[model samples]
Target: MKVRATAKRVAFGLCVFCLLVYLVFPFGWALVSSFKTNAELFATPARFWPAHPTLEHYRHVLANDDFLRAALNSVFVACSVTLVSLAIGALSAFALGRYRFRGRSLVLYVVLSMTLFPQIAVLGALFQLVNALGLYNRLPALTLTYLVFTLPFTVWVLTGFLEAVPIEIEEAAIMDGASPLQLFAKIMLPLAAPGMVTTGLLSFIAAWNELLFALSFMQTPDKRTVTYAILSFSATTSSAFEVPWGQMMAASVLVTTPLVVLALIFQRRIIAGLTAGAVKG
Candidate 1:
């Protein structure tokens, strides 16, 4: 029996090692490749470590015209979408979690149904709507469009979190002459902080990384987000025949680094928020 258990442990360790390699390898390769020059990158049987490690790619990407603007655009749009989604979602979730209302399940079904709608299917109509609203090719338009994706999930997650908060605590607040607003502000909101953070982070990442809508809605180069900025390297110019892989990868790393840091920082809270209501009634 001991021998069998030891073998099982060995197998589990091997499986975990494989999974970590699978996840880490691509990112490691990207980091390595980002340091390679254009000439070195195409060299046969690419070197794992560049013989002459260079900061050229990072400098070039950062110095590129409109790169900083694009990064700021993405940050602004993402922050806006996350904040708006959290506010609206939290309010709706609180209402649904705390009170019974007519068509409650139906409302949830409708919200979930919106999530099922493919972005591609609505792109044409949404583009027209944005144009009609005179918000075409603007960050606000992208933020609004992102809502179609983030709001549903935020509402769903926050509803679960709010539901998990005990009614007894809320009841006690109510009996202590707490107004509805006071109870929610002083009690429920504090209790739901973890969920809010989790949902907001997810929303921010979604809005930040979204490429398709950013590509479609944004036309001006200076107004483009980081995802759209990648296309700048793909343009066919007299001097360049191929995309700048090193710079593109470097830019991608820059764009994604903050999200990685955020995830590392709050991974535990995110897990707790996701699981908070699962075990509760």
Candidate 2:
């Protein structure tokens, strides 16, 4: 029995090791490929290390005026989406989680159902609406459109978190002369902070990486986001008649670096937040 158990443990370890390799190998390849020169990249069988590592790609990408503008547009859209989604999601979640409203389950089902609809299906209508409002190709329009995908998920997750908070605590706060606003702002908000961070992080990442809407809505080069900028690298041409793989990869690395750092820094809080809602309930 002991030998069997030992074998099982070894098997589990091997599975985990394999999973880690599967996830990390692509990133490792991208990182290495980003440094290789155009000649080195297309060489047969591709060497793991760049024989002549250079920062020319990074320099070229950063030197472009449009890159900075695209990055800024992405940041603005993502930040606005995250803040707005959180505020609206939190309010809706509290009503659903704390109060005994008629047709509450029906309302939640309808909200969740929105997530099932493909973005492409409504793109035409949304584009027309934004254009009618004179917000086409604008950052605010993109931010508002992003909420269509993000808001439902945020509400679902936050509702779970809010429901996990014991009602007795809220009652006690009320007994202590706490107004509804005070109870929510002081007590409930603090307890729900972790969940808020988790949901906001997700919303930010979604908006940051969104490509379809940005591509469809924004017409001008300057109004594009990072994803659009990256696409431009492939779309636009140089006199050389070759794609700049190294520079594209470098741009990708630059764009994703902050997200990687954020994930690493908030790893603990994110995990805690995800589990806290279920654990308390």
Candidate 3:
């Protein structure tokens, strides 16, 4: 039995290691490439580490005004989407979780089903709406479009978490003359903090990385997201023939590092939030 257990542990460890390598390889390669000079990058045999590392690519990217502006644009759009999703999702989740209403199950199913549609499925309809509202080429257009995807997901996840909250607490609050809004503000929001952080961070990352909607809605050069900024390297340069792989990699690393940091900081909360919804006491 001891021999069998040891073999099982070893097999599990190997499987975990393989999964880690698969997930980390692309980001690791991007990080490695960010430090290398253009000459060393495409050299024969393709060395993993640069012989002489330099920070020129990072410096160039930072110095570019359009890049900085695009980063700001992305930040604005993502934060708006996250904050709106959370506020609206929390209220909807509270209602659906705590209140019994007609077609409640159907409502939950509809919200869940919204996630099933690919972004492309809604892009055309959204485009016509944006143009009709005269929001074309504006930052708000991106924020509005992103909410369609993020809000439903937020509502769905938070509903499960809110459902897991103890009903007695809410009842006690009501007995003490706490209004529904007061109970939600004072009692439920705090308990849902972990779930909020999880969903908010996920929503932010989605908005930050989204290129299709960004490309479709925003026409102005200054209104693009950071991911689009990476692509714009070719367009802004004096020579169209020149490819700035090193700089582009640096930008990718810059864009991706914050998300990594956020995940690391909130990984425990994310785990707790996700698992908290899976089980009900």
Candidate 4:
């Protein structure tokens, strides 16, 4: 029995190690390649490690005015989307989760159905709408378009968190002569902080990484997002072989690392927020 238990432990450890390697290898390779030179990146043997690591790719990508501007645009749009999504979603979720209302089920289903639609399906309609509104090629366009998807998700996730809050608390506030807005502002929002953080972070990442909406809505160079800037690095050359792999990898790392760090930092809150609504207290 002792021998069998030891073998099981060893096998479990090996399986976990393999899973970690599979999941982490791609990002690890990208990070390593970010440090490599053009010649080293596409060496004859396709080396895993750079012979001479350098920061040239980072410098070049940072020096590009287009990349810099796009980074700023992405930051603005992502932050806007997060703030707006949270504000509106919190209100919607609270109403849906807490109050009795007409068409509540229908409204929730409609919101859920919106998430079911593919981005491509709405592309044409969104294009015409944005053009009609004179929002084409603008950063605010992304802020609005992104809400189509992000808002639904934020509401859905946050509904659970809000629902998990003990109803007795809300009842107590009500009995204490708290107005509806005061009750929500002073009581409910604070309780849902974990869910809010998770949803906001997810919304920010979605807006930051959004490509299709950005491509369609933003035509002007100044309003383009980071994803477009990454594409620009590869689009500089005609031939596939001439594409700047080093810079592309470097830019990818730059774009991905920060979000990954945030997710890791708030991983506990993310887990808690996601599952908070599953069971009532």
Candidate 5:
């Protein structure tokens, strides 16, 4: 019995280790491959590590004007979307979490259901609306469209956070002459920080990596986002199309760096947000 238990533990540990390697290996290879030259990449028998690693690919990506513009556009659109979604979602979450009114549950249900709708389902309508508003080929269009997905997610996650706050806290704030807006701004908002951080991080990542909307809405090269810019990195010379694997890998590594840093910085908050109100004592 003791031997069997030990064997099971060893097997479980090995499985977990393998899983970690499987998940991380691709990114690891990309990071290493980004430094290799085109010749090194195509060498016989293939090399796991570069013989002479160089920063040329990274430099090439940075020196490109269009890529830089796209990077800025991505940051602008993503940040704008996150801010707008958080503001709208926070107010809606507070009302739904704290108040009782006619059709409140139904409203919450509707908002939650919006998240379940596939992006492709509403793609056509969204394009029409953007064109009608004359926002096509603009960063604001991306910001506006991203709200369809981010806002609902933020509201759902934040409602859970707001509900976890003890009613007594709000009652005490009211007793101290705090109005509804003051209570939310001064009290509940601070308490819901973890949920807000988690939601904001997720929203930013989603917007940053979104390719379809960016592609469809912004046709101009200068207005495209990082995801779209990566696609354009495929080189076309003299009727021969060549994919710049090294440069693409470099861009991928750079693009992924910010998200990894954010996740690491907010790792604890993300866990707290996810587990909020899970086990009530």
Candidate 6:
């Protein structure tokens, strides 16, 4: 029995090691390849390590005006979407979670339905609407489009967290002459902070990494987000289609760094928020 258990433990550890390698290998390769010259990258032996690592790709990416502009565009659009979605979602969540109005469940179902809809399904209609609003090629267009996804998700998650908050606390605040606004701002919002952070982080990440809408709506070069900018490298004048793999990898690392740092910093909050309503006290 002890021999069998030891074998099982060994098998489990091997499985975990394989999973980690599967997940980490691509990013690890990208990190390594980012520093390799084209000649070294295309070498016959397939060098795991560059003969001579270089910082030129990173430097080039950092100095490029378009890359910098695209980074700023991503930041602006993502931040806007997160803030707007959270503000509106919080109110909608409070209403849905707290109130027992007509069609309340229906409303939640509708919101969930919106979230589940494929972006491709709404692409044509959204494009037309953006053009009608004269927001085409604009950063605000991305922000507005992002709301279609982020707001629904935020509302649903926050609603769950809000529902978990003790009703007794709300009643006490109301009895103490707390108006609806005071109750929400002071009591409910504080209690649901973990959920807000988690939802907001998710929303921000989605908006930051969104590619389809960013590609479809935005036409101006400078206004494009980092995701779209990555593809821009594919169309260099050096050749009809010569992708700068090194620079692309370097840019990818830069683009991914912020998200990694964000998750690392708020990982605890994310876990706490996800588990907040799982067990009722």
Among all candidates shown, the one with the greatest TM-score: 3
- Model 3 TM-score? 0.98
lDDT of each: 0.89, 0.89, 0.93, 0.91, 0.92, 0.92
For each candidate, what TM-score against the reference? 0.95, 0.95, 0.98, 0.93, 0.96, 0.95
Better of 3 and 4 by TM-score: 3
Q: List the residue pairs that clash in candidate 6.
A: none
Backbone clashes in model 3, listed as residue pairs: none
Q: Highest lDDT: which candidate?
A: 3
How many steric clashes between backbone atoms does each model show? 0, 0, 0, 0, 0, 0
Question: On a 0 to 100 scale, what is the lDDT of residue 115 in model 6?
Answer: 85
Which regions in candidate 1 have their CA more than 4 angstroms from the true location?
Answer: 236-238
Ranking by TM-score: 3, 5, 6, 1, 2, 4
For candidate 4, give the lDDT: 0.91
Residue 179 error for model 5, in Å? 0.4
Query: What TM-score would candidate 4 get against the native?
Result: 0.93
Query: What digit string (tens of lDDT, one per residue) describes model 4 on residues 1-281?
Result: 99999999999999999999999999999999999988888688888888899999999989989998999999999999999999999999999888878998888889889999999999999889899999998888899999999999999888778878888899999999999999889999999999998999999999999999988887777888999889877776558668898888999999999999999999999888888978765
Write model 1 residue lDDT over 130-151, tens digit each, in one string: 8999998888999999999999
Model 1: lDDT to the true structure: 0.89
Residue pairs that clash (backbone atoms under 3 angstroms), model 5 = none
Q: Which ten residues in a row have the lowest lDDT in candidate 4?
A: 232-241
Question: Candidate 3 lDDT, tens digit per residue, 1-281?
Answer: 99999999999999999999999999999999999998998899999899999999999999999899999999999999999999999999999989999999999999999989999999999999999999999999999999888999999989999999998999999999999999999999999999999899999999999999988998777888898889889887767888899999999999999999999999998888788768666
